[model samples]
Target chain A: MNDKKWIVLGLILFVGLFSFPFWFNVGKAAPAPEVVLTEQAKAAKECVMPTDFMKTEHMQLLDVWRLKVVRDGVSQFVNADGKEFDMSLSNTCLDCHSNKAEFCDRCHNYASVNPYCWDCHIDNPKGDK
Target chain B: MNKFYMSSLLAIFALALIAWVGAPALPWLFGIVLPYLAVAVFVVGFVRRVMGWSRSAVPFAIPTTGGQQRSLPWIKQAKFDNPSSKTGVFVRMALEILTFRSLFRNTRMKMNEGNRLSYHLEIFLWLGALAFHYAFLVTLLRHMRFFLEPVPGAIQMLEAVDGFFRLEILYDSVQFGLPGVYMSGLVLLAAAAYLFLRRLFIANMRYISLPSDYFPLLLIMGIAFTGILMRYFTKVDIAAIKQLAMGLVTFQPSIPAAISPVFYIHLFFVSVLLAYFPFSKLMHLGGIFLSPTRNMLANTREVRHVNPWNYPVKVHTYEAYENEFREKMVEAGLPVDKMPESAPEEMTEEEKE
Candidate 1:
């Protein structure tokens, strides 16, 4: 009985502490700050455009490389850089985007966005290339 | 029939009623107190359950093998299904955890011509399950930025990659309108609902389905529903909610008033899920490690196993019995050894004196 009472009391205290946030800002109603896109952000956004004609060329090059590897029946090591590597289904895309940290992180931090992927995925930004 | 299911149903119904009746007073308890309690319960309960499972004795290597056992070189083997080595087992476990490989191979039986049984490939369940799990994973990954102070670069990269297809025109014009719709959340809910409904509606599934299964499905659905409501309908202050979440993560509690009551409702449901996860079927997350089928190897046939429970017992030897039986055997005209010419015959005590 005593143990139960203590537990209940502890829960009450914890809840009271958590509730401070709701009550603390009762008088304040400041709106969130608007996000301003920088030149780099605009460039990054443009680079990712769905209708960008350059993407077709990029995709075609990838397809040609894939076809060549498949035809040769040889292990495709590295990304056009002639470095030795393992071939697996998991690392298919990593062949090209070897420097992921350099290419990807700049825009994301600017956007103030959070992504849940790092929970389990390992970032192998620097591959054989 | 099962206590777990019955209790779950009762608790859920009771909570639903409480939420309905105490709607006016929910902001105090549901918004604040319940979440704290749930988190406490989740952490403690998960640890306790895992410890208990780890302590339990498993005296046998009872791995469920679906292929040929390790034997002579001449014999054929099932390499992937019944792995013979540690590396193979690790590979199998990896595939199973990451891709639900076993579920993918699931088949359904049906009657064919002449009433013959035939197996049909059932891929819908696998697809739905995969969608649900991956979506859940993605959603979880997206939420990590709220918890950590200096968000990792890798996570940022993933976020950018995920939202790469966003309309540039909209991005330039509005500047912000919920960035991009997190498709994973919607996909997760839809897939989970499909799985739940299939179990409820399908005959075979319904027969095997117990209340425990239904409860988790319902609870998850409820959580998803509340979350969707918060996102699309309520439109709570994201910044304030993040501040509150960050504060919780930091151990310094500050509840922002701008956070809506609907957000509280969503938090309450999430809290309930956390508390229930440890005690409920969701513990399969931990139980997978202890599963004999997944962890053990099938090597029992090659090795001798002594029953640990065997007790010592006195045994009667034949030689001691023979001395007592020798006189009786000679009198009864049974075959006996000549005094010095032949060896004496051995006998058991029950046969002799």
Candidate 2:
């Protein structure tokens, strides 16, 4: 009985440590970030990519669009719907969705993504945050 | 015995590294498909193996007792080595699993000048094995940042603690920025090397060691080496790797182009190891818990252990034996439990009937 005391203590510790992740998570996770769409997105009739594709694979698509437009000097993108549009982010995409807070930042923050597009291309150039 | 482990290990690593270098042509297969397949196999195979072990029933109190059993109340019993109750059994099993207590008690035999063989404490194998397993666990926990979005707070704290002791305290409090140096990876590699060299160099151990014994060590070493190389030498794109790892867990796996070729080699080795783990001695990771000899209590003195398969067996009864050997027994003047019938009595039987 005396020697068995350590077993009880060890068991308590084992269960405690293994379950720490779950216990620590209790009443503690951040609530999901919300996406808010404004009139800027509502007024734009179409986007360079389809809406669903943009929703899921927008990062990869943006990566490819960045490489081609910046490096290869290919500024025009033909959508699957056979509509050609300028592939410039600052001039074409931001032209319609100028409010970064209403559009880009919402979904990006929700997904916890840090897109490098803003590193070189400023989201706001009028000395604004 | 043939010293083939090192060459085979190097060949496998070099070939895998070459394949990774050539992976750009078919990035999807090596990067996306194999990791998913390996993880799937690891989960299903591990569960199946454990379930298979559970199906067998232990019908005997066959624990390997190394100490005194529970007897007279006056005599002290070894509660752990020869456990008499479930609690003692639990403690023994916990010690065996957590600290490899049995292995820690390992001894080596050495022939003395007087031709007398003596036993010496062999702590290196135990120490190396312990260090290897513990460091591997820490490294694995530290890798959670790659697989989770934003990473969990506990994992972050663990990573910070691990980095704090990453041989950084001795370097004048200088912190290695971005991806700092990790001691766990290096310690795992060193421990594995010690285990490997011990088997390879020792004559008796080398003679007894088989290809199967060396295979897992080599495979694990290859994994650690490649992982370290990618971390310190080639310098993989950390963001791309996180994206890839997160994607796999999310069931939306995608290969990031910015990821280096070295990372692919690391992934390839890991996949091979995972797929091979179920059938290899690596299954010992799960078997330590299931072993009846380690898990069972020595309670035979306090309780009866009836064999479930016990059944009636044919044997000659004493009455039948006496009846058949009555003449021989009487001739030999041997006393029997029952008396044999006399000849005169048999002759009078006709008149009596």
Candidate 3:
């Protein structure tokens, strides 16, 4: 009842501002993307890496792939699972998952990642998916 | 300030180094969980501390009045200095918080050549303080880049403006004259060093300063130093940092492999800072707002400010006094409200109104 109201209000403000990141994300979990690979990826019926591995490590894998193709002049990749594929991100990976919005943006948008690979390595298709 | 500062300073660096070495062995713990836990502790502890203060009762409207209070309407009240209204209180608090107005008006007393005391504005301390606080704020806002994805436009604009003074020199057709050299970091470092030294160099300040006062300053400096080192000298990979930072942002934390040891050291410093914040004088950031002297309206004369906790006490009325001492009252010349049977009627009818 005294004039200590500001203290409580200020405390609330402090707590609110600090805990913003924790609550700003509450009930905002964008569902995982349903990855639909193109006919090329489906026809091969096999991927450079296992589905589980690709699910988590695709970004780094693509990063390493880009490094190998662009800098080291290495076109072949040998996954930990003993699978060999071209180290080209645009042609090798994107060729099968041509529908960028459906395949890449699915998880990326859910996770709020805007990868800049399309800035240089254009999303040009080998043909229509 | 002498050995305590050195020991605390060394302790912070030792912690940073420990975190650096421990990070490789426990990457997720250092890179992800620690930051989250530190932030959580900071938020909860800050709230608890402030709320604890709030539960205490303030019985008086004792705003530290620097100017005239609102008396007669003809007497012009000093709204900013001795505010009688809520709006005036806000303005005073704003000036105090935004500009460190009291500090700006700081004075130092010195004995003149003629043996007379003289007061002068201690402007350097104020300037250093102003520079340090502002620079720290800018640096904090600038670091929002690593945590936020797609970096908000406002932050980008702020970053550009902060780095606007960078003198661009053509190097191999790429303009790079110290890529965004934030003077804020250097200014903050200098100001902190000056403030820290002031306590040591000046006898009065050294006598007054406790280890508590010096520790937070040294700890903050440690945080700033490690941060600057990571940013400028031993450059950490920005992308890997972004991965780690963004992981925390999205609540999907994964430790990035091969992140720089310097980055871990910097992160450890920051984590320690966060954890230490609520328990330390850093809570002054929030306490300033809650200060009754700064926040309360100086209107004691105009309004009857009641004490909420004031208790009621029994009163001894004249009737009770006469009833309790009727015989004694009749024995003396003292008048009583009621007449006793043995008392004189003339004296009993006394209209003492």
Candidate 4:
């Protein structure tokens, strides 16, 4: 048991010592040609977008609507033209972003991002061409 | 000066070195093999800890109640705080776990003009904690897309709902850039940082804070930092990562080419976190069930508590006492069942019988 402990400790120490540079070097070295914008800058840019999209002032209204709908066990959905419509969670979002690979993969690929989400989550909605 | 700070800094330095040196030589082992091992350890350790908790004997129904228990008709009762029945306990536990009801009622004391104590609502901590937990949960749920061949619609829906503000803009056009910016990750990081800082800065909190408390916070922060790095800075192959994750889930493991070394470093920290979770203060996730404050009801005062240690004893009968004292009672002019002269003979006869 003692020997095993020492071995595991040694291995952890070895791994830890070797893995630091990879973490620290991120975003510090030469900027990759594919790099579009830093995460901070991206967030900042989004913060400056139009108020309608940002919804900062209208958050209370949305919150009230959400609380009422959820409390009453009512499902609220609308079509693209704001017409009354019935839709599930997936269809509601996927209706707009149709091509998952083209849209999601393109940016993530350029960004060199590894999203484990696709492992379990369905990227493409069924019955959507 | 503390062991936690010393050890964490040392570990961080070591990992930085390893990441630099081991990049080219053992990318596959670091990137692919280590993550698989971590996930396995996480699942097994989590289950074992939960099982161990379940197996431990409670020996008593000790639900912690903060309100009045149900008693007489005249007695005013606090139903939610002090629940007397099983249903009430269930409701209380549900509220506690789902909404952190107790934390929402937290109070902080401050000294006023004359050093008089004043109580104020401390809702920020509660809100921060709530935000952190929900964000962590959502982020975990969103990651489900990587492990399964066909991701669940529910998870996709969650991602959409989370990124609704971003996705709704391009109704007809296919627009995507680092989808959603993973706002939950940022929120979780901020909350965790705030909690850590609060513990460090507040004199009372700092006095009571232990190395165990700080270590978990550091580990979690490390995981978050690495994750952010992988997403925005040193990009790894998502498709390859998905394949690797799927392979691990399915039990046929394979390391895809072109996976980044930084990804492995992130995975390593996450794995370390998982392995440490069961042994650390993080067990509070399970410890909430055993908490005296949350589990014990305030009914001990009203109920009769018989100590399980009462025993029976042999005793002399009153008739025997009267017979022995009859002669003495006659001599002293007290009433006797038999005459003194007859009593002695009668006693002898009784003895013989």
Best by DockQ: 3
Candidate 3 Cα outliers beyond 4 Å, as residue runs: A1-6, A23-129, B72-76, B167-178, B313-322, B325-353
- Give the alpha carbon lDDT tens digit for every residue of A61-92 in model 2: 55556667767888788888898878777777
> Candidate 2 on B30-58: residue-level lDDT in tens?
77888778766876677677666665556
User: Candidate 3 docking: what grade?
Assistant: incorrect
Using lDDT as the measure, name the better of candidate 2 and candidate 4.
2
Q: Backbone clashes per model, in order?
A: 7, 0, 0, 41
What DockQ does each candidate score versus the true complex, computed on alpha carbons?
0.03, 0.04, 0.12, 0.02
Candidate 4 structure lDDT: 0.60
Candidate 2 C-alpha RMSD relative to the actual structure: 11.2
TM-score of 2: 0.66
For lDDT, candidate 1 versus 2, the one ahead is: 2
Interface RMSD of each: 13.2, 11.0, 8.3, 15.8
On TM-score, the stronger of 2 and 3 is: 3
lDDT of 3 by residue, A1-129 (tens): 554675676667767766555555554432234667778778988778876546544655676566567767888988777887888877788878788877887655443345557778777566565
Q: After superposition, how far is residue B336 of candidate 4 from its true place, in Å?
A: 21
Q: Compared with the true structure, what per-residue lDDT tens digits does model 4 show for residues B127-199?
A: 9889888988888777766654345567667876766554222212322233346777777788888888887
Report the TM-score of chain B alone for all candidates.
0.77, 0.83, 0.87, 0.77
For candidate 1, the docking band is: incorrect
